[model samples]
Target chain A: MRDKNLNSKLKNNFGAKANDSRIYIFLVIVFVIIAAIYPAFFTSGSIKALVSTSLIYIIVGVGFTYVMIGGNFDLSIGSIINAGAVVTMGEFNRFYKIFGGVEGGDSALIKAWILAFACAIGVGLLIGFVNGFLVAKVKVHSFIVTIGMLTTVAGFVYTYSHGNSISANTYSLVDVIDKSFVKIPYLEVFTPRFVIAIILVVVFEFILLKTKWGYDLFMVGSNKESSFFAGINTVKKVWITFIISGFTAALGGSLFAVSMNAAVPNFGERGIAPLMFVLAATIIGGTAMLGGSGSVVKTAVATIVIQSIFSFLISMGMGFDAQVLAAGVVLGAVVFFESFSVYRQGLKEGERPALVLEAEQLRLKK
Target chain B: MSSDNSASVVTLKSNTGKVSFNTIANRFGVFLMIAVLLVVGAFASPRFFSGANWLNILSAVSILGMVAVGVSFVIYCGKYGDMSVPMVMALSGVISVEFMRYGIVPSFLGAVAVGAVIGLINGIVIGKLKVNAIIWTLAMNFILEGLIRWSYHGTQIYPDMATAVTYKTGFLLPLMAKLDPNIMNIDLTMRAENFNALAQTYFAGGIPLMLVVMVIIMIIGYFIQSKSSYGNKLKVVGSNYDVGNMSGIRATTIVMLAFMISSICASFAGVFITSVNKVGAFYVGAGYDFQAVTAIILGGMSLSGGRGNIIGVAGGVIMLGLITNILNLFGVGTFTQKMISGAIFIVVVAVNANSLRKLGKDDA
Candidate 1:
């Protein structure tokens, strides 16, 4: 009994990876509960709809999680996604003209798809790099830098699209996005989007957990000064996270554009809603806001779980307002609980979280 | 803080015995930008630098000015912005307009009270509980906005003339009637006309009453941030709460007051906005929270708290207004103007950050 107690404490207190199991357990419980209460949730159609609806959020969120783990924010993801969508269409439009507009054939279609996707991701990379440069090198707070990016990007997209939705249905990417790679009877069908999202989760989660670069990024976020002393390139690590975040967001945005066959940017040009959702989702997924910890897989699973909870509420006849309200309530409660836990944990440890400790040293010096 | 600032000045003088113009230009970049904007406006268009246009710009920015200064207090205290500003505005305006059958004073009073309550909750949850300010307030924003939309059936509430009734009180009744009938004090028929005329009515030449309120808020915000002991306490708290606690400051109270002050200000802006649109909906002030934050940052308010100037923030607000006005004067389309304004925001902030870095004050 004594040994077991010591083991539990050791496992729970020191490792960022420990919470991974609890979240997975929670996912299992959520699944069982929902499955039992609303058996229709087991239906393939319901599952497919659920995954489809949450796929983009999950995809954007995976990249967002990397940034959060590195202790910064990329608030312009939604706008980047919007930009991705716009760029995809613009590229496709230009390339389609060159390749052959109406009778473009499969070759033109293939060419446009490859080029558009590459260009869209390229834009995301560029924007993300700029955001990184501003925050890391220019020494601006990440929040304001990303916000500046948001406004600039939104403005550019709004100008490009003239505040109207740009339809790219003719490009045929939408039809390709929903193509099912695998079908599960009475449960769900795995579309290319869902497959890509999972593949991203697995690959990024591995990199985040096992790579030296990933470890350095976490160190920088957990304590920049210490990491700097330890000879980690704190600047480079933080900057790299922004690029990853930008790439993922851009990928999600372009995919969204193709899936919808239109760049419906009027709603998301400001990027606030997507930013809010990703923030809420990451926190809910158990990524520490103060950094030093997160899981891409957990965030993806949590995104799906959150969607399920929404579906459950809708199944209970809750209106759209109820979903929004519930989301807010859940987010608030989670943040409050998370902070309270940290405060309590600090009391036991006899020192506060790094956020407070760092601020204390810095401010008192002045 | 003033002494500290002056001490720096003295040391700089002792070290060099003179000030570099480049340093001054970088340090007072916001002010220099405003001057640049003014000159550019003058050169770019004939109608850009007129007295009337300036008033138009000032009046146009007053609502945002009220908000930026309002949020500045919270930033001054070192909290992330009140993400609920937009919802607070929407809900408070709807509440005030719904109560407009009561006198305008009472209506505004009621709305402000509601706003204060929301602020208090934020204070408790964020200040006392130490929740992440950004996410918690964001949650509060979503919850309140969702609740308002749900209850109101996702529709904007237009002021109803038929339901308008002047809530009469003692000796004030006569004064209210005499001054109010022009604005449909009693009903919807005259509300728009009265609102238009009231908006047009300037308290000072080329300066409206809202601008006056904006100025007063800035003065008060500045005074509280710098001169008052409370302000010092707030800076201490913002700089480091644990340290502030050990030093015996009522950190909780200071934070609560900061939030309450912003929310109260939001209530006033809310009413102004609702009246301006003559309707209340959840979408009202949708982007104001972000816009206000940008203005604050542009004005030289640091995000880490305990470091900023309200006067610079005021200049930031004016620069934003100037950007829009100048762009319009140049006959730029709406889409292009947004791009230009955003670009300006990034460039100006980048320069500010670079200068601060050069000064050996790092944000990252």
Candidate 2:
């Protein structure tokens, strides 16, 4: 009996380790499936496309993860992306006019790209600051507040643009985005956008893992009251995180607009997919959705894996609509499956399932 | 025990402040905005006060009212809702139309069943697994959308030949036809003929089935929320799980029951919507979850759980209906209307919180 008990404990410990490793395992399995289906998936062209798309999503996802990790959500990101697109395109257009560039093509394209990106990021920061302030300081839950913003800003997109598309005047930016560049190939160039995504992940990972603000974020996420007790100035951390999230999402929006070559009014309306997919990626990467305890690196890798699976599916003749349906089914099933362990624990304890909620709060205490 | 006394004392203290004062205050924030809007609308448009305008308001409120009723349960239970009400409504409409080939009853049942299943999944995930209700429900929403899109191949569901040609088009058609010719140029009327009439007309052209149903559901919801032992249990569960567990309430079960209630309400709304609209689409429940949530918040139901009743939610629904009506009467643009509604929602919720705080309970 003693030996059996000891063996069971060892097995349990190993099981816990495996569970933690499940996300990585899942990513590998997905990649393997993609590779098996499309042998050419590993080629430079495919990798470049996958990496570029993954970079855009990752940038936005990482910013969003910051808010989720802090125990809130920003439904406004999609609309914000739309807003960013509008802002960038509008600003780029005006700048081109002032600088007297040729219509639809430009000698000043590179400088215009830089200026547009900077302006886009600024707008993103401003929106994020407002969102963060309303939620943290004004004491409103993120959902209601963001929903309000979604409408107001979505309206602004229509009002400012009068429901029209805005295009950048920089042909060079478009040229750089659509095709290869130099011998490196923009597709395989490890472009600035890709580099920016990586840098963001690394910087955020370091800050979250090592900085005082990072610790405060964890504390606030874990338990708001306790964080208050710890003198973390919990509200400031919450507000700042939300603001940073907004800023990062805006940057992503600008890049996305550049890649797409036009800023469509519906840009933000399509945020549902990005929002849910990012959440799934974050959670699958072993970040607790309950808040805190996640890494941007994990989210970044998971984004690649998810995009690859999606691409593989598309390549295999699954229509775009079916893929959308499949994503939803996958998300629902994954959340249900992953959370089953906690439910089972509740069952074993002969306690009501509600007892499991305590685990979320309990983790914070630890 | 001491804590129990303290809580009870607090509840009792707040109970004396005008039976519906809390709800009124919560709604008052939005009401104030609506009042301003009414003044502006009346000044802007001469037709704003016509009896026809009031009828238009009632007609418009019917469809969203169905959704709001269903979501009220989820909010009341403190479950984060964002489930596939839109898809459920759309699918229910589709399935119903398909069944209309066979007969009316079959179509109605098929549509409602799909809605119930959607709600069932929502309940299992949110209630049983204790996942983040909003995230889980949001996922479910997309999945339902995917299903609807795939099944329809991204097309809208239109009325069936059998229903359109055979059964007098459910009962809302002719009434709307008559009303449409005299109305303003605004095209917001339910394009599907049958729905407009059923919602607009009642028995013998007097009371609308939609309004009757709304009232019935509201009353039932109120009874469940206030008078039933089960309702009391849910209240305790939502208010504070620890205290509820100590009090011998199974918080998980209570929460699940709440979700089930919400799903049923959503299903009922779905069937009625199909009957009325004669069509369903991806955008059916697009902004509804948030809208209903806003209404609940404005109704003074605390987000932290267990503080208000269904009557409060009813007040919110009515007020929201009123605001939409007033806006339409004045010919405000859709984009502007959305902004006004959103801003009003935020301010109303804020004011609701303040009132709740003043009363000594956390407003959440």
Provide all candidates' interface root-mean-square deviations. Answer: 2.2, 1.8
**Model 1, B248: alpha-carbon shift in Å?**
2.3
Candidate 2 lDDT over B65-135, as tens digits, reads 66776777677676645556666666666655544443446656766676677777777777768887877
Deviation of model 2 at A4, angstroms: 6.8
Give a tens-digit lDDT track for model 1, residues B1-364: 8756855664475458576453575447678889999999998888886789988898889999989988998988888688789989988887776556565677778789989999999988888877767767777887787677666555567664324334231112235466666533345555434543434557646577777877887788789778999889988888788899899898989999899988888888888888777777788887788788878877877676877778888988999899889888878997777677677767767776665544445442
Model 1, A1-366: lDDT tens digits are 545554565566645555655677778899999888888887778888888988888899988999889888888887898899888887888888789976978898889879989999999999999998987877777777786788788888888778778876484667668877656564345888888988898899888889988788788889989999999988888888899889999899988888888886665422226766677778878888898888888788778888888888999898776677677677777777788878777667854344555576679889
lDDT of 2 at B123: 76
Candidate 2 chain B, run of 10 with poorest lDDT: B165-174
Local distance difference test, candidate 1? 0.78
Candidate 2 Cα outliers beyond 4 Å, as residue runs: A1-12, A103-115, A177-189, A268-272, A345-366, B1-41, B160-208, B275-277
- CAPRI verdict (incorrect, acceptable, medium, high) for model 1: medium
Q: How well does candidate 1 score on lDDT at residue B220?
A: 85
lDDT of each: 0.78, 0.71
What are the per-residue Cα lDDT tens digits for candidate 2 across A263-342?
Answer: 88786243236666776777777776668667788888888887888888877888766778888887777777767866
